[model samples]
Target: MKSLSLIVLLSMVFSCNTSAQKKDDQLQNKTAFKVTKTDAEWKAQLTDDQYQVLRKAATERPFSSPLNNNHSKGTYVCAACKTPLYKSEHKFDSGTGWPSFDRVIEGNVAFSTDTTIGYMRNEEHCATCGGHLGHVFDDGPRATTGKRHCINGDALEFVPAKS
Candidate 1:
């Protein structure tokens, strides 16, 4: 009788563990997060490198961003707003010294006229918060979009999507 009771108790614990794991999985699958911040609030929340790349419109050195070699399944988010900006599947090796994505998360990033470097370039920014991300160019392989979203690695934080 004691052996039978022990088996029943173990079964109950296994069932509960499985249920908890399911709930955890559901929560982890969620990618949506609140994305609103005041200027000062954002400045305080981010570091100097994050602020420069995400706020003041700066770029990191070529192949200098850690994300340049990041080949993980995830979503890249704006360091300022936490808005989903790119998918890991869209990220690729561009040999441009920055993390390059073939595309961005929908309705998250926007393009603008950037003349800061004394040349006309497509500047990228967080669409929801107006935070600078980097630039985009037409030089990319034909396998994906002919556009490369040249992003400052400091401006982004990658969150792996649940498979």
Candidate 2:
């Protein structure tokens, strides 16, 4: 019947649209936010683990980074471009095995749609180098910004504040 044919055509069109959307949902960062370096240069500059997490959008193991336990007063900068991202005052213990902060330095971090694990999440990136930092969540200190910037310690380097 003509009605059945119309239904089949509509289904095909919708299916194609869905497939295209899925393909576009990948968390790959193709746009360079600021710092742009060759792959070889990045490999030469960063450690193996740091390269993996920052460039490949991978997460480090829980409790693997010493920064998680660091309580020193200092600023945390991006591993790739050394852009100041978070302060020691915003750091807190979320028991998530990563360096967590109440908020990020405004406009110093970028966000993108991440669907690598088949679920959509707002993935954080270094505004300077476009490196993967981590995800931000709404569950955080009620007294502060109430936003949790769960960052990978390997993606950050701490600089102790001078007395």
Candidate 3:
């Protein structure tokens, strides 16, 4: 019957998609990271909040981090891997309660599609460790990349410039 044939074809298509997704996940897991560590090690290295956000891709409460209001000349590095990610000049208050940057240090950040929030958004991660930093959106200052690197402050550690 046509109905039976259609059902079988649909099942095969979905099965192939699932298999492909699994393969992609395996490939990502094997990606060479400069700062690789076990879950236990990472937990030990990072604070509770940092572990939750960097290791588990959790978001911090908005307007909670003092980093959001900080305007000093400095560099923001990954709290987990200490990789320089965003410069203070790139940071802007998007009024979104999170620190928003118009750009990042090239080659220091990687992006992948994140569907954890029930929608697909470009999730930024530390290139060295694959630790979750935050999401990048298209809404940003048009003078630059027109991209907003909406980052979680807990995922970053600011290093101020010497006077």
Which candidate wins on TM-score?
A: 3
The candidate with the higher TM-score, 1 or 3, is 3
Each candidate structure's TM-score, on Cα atoms with residue i matched to residue i, is 0.74, 0.84, 0.88
Candidate 3: stretches off by over 4 Å:
17-31
Per candidate, the number of residue pairs that clash is 2, 0, 0
* Over 4 Å off, model 1: 1-39
* CA RMSD per model (angstroms): 18.0, 3.6, 2.5
lDDT of 3 by residue, 1-163 (tens): 9999999999998777565465346325736678789999998899999999898889999999999999999999999888999999999989999999999999999777778769988888898988889999999999888999999999999999888
Quote the positional error of residue 104 for candidate 3 in Å.
Answer: 1.3
User: In model 2, which residue pairs have backbone atoms overlapping below 3 Å?
Assistant: none
Among residues 3 or more apart in sequence or in different chains, the pairs in candidate 1 whose N, CA or C atoms overlap within 3 Å are 62-97, 63-97
Tens-digit lDDT track of model 1 for 69-109: 99989999987777899998888888888999888888887
Worst 10 residues of 2 by lDDT: 22-31
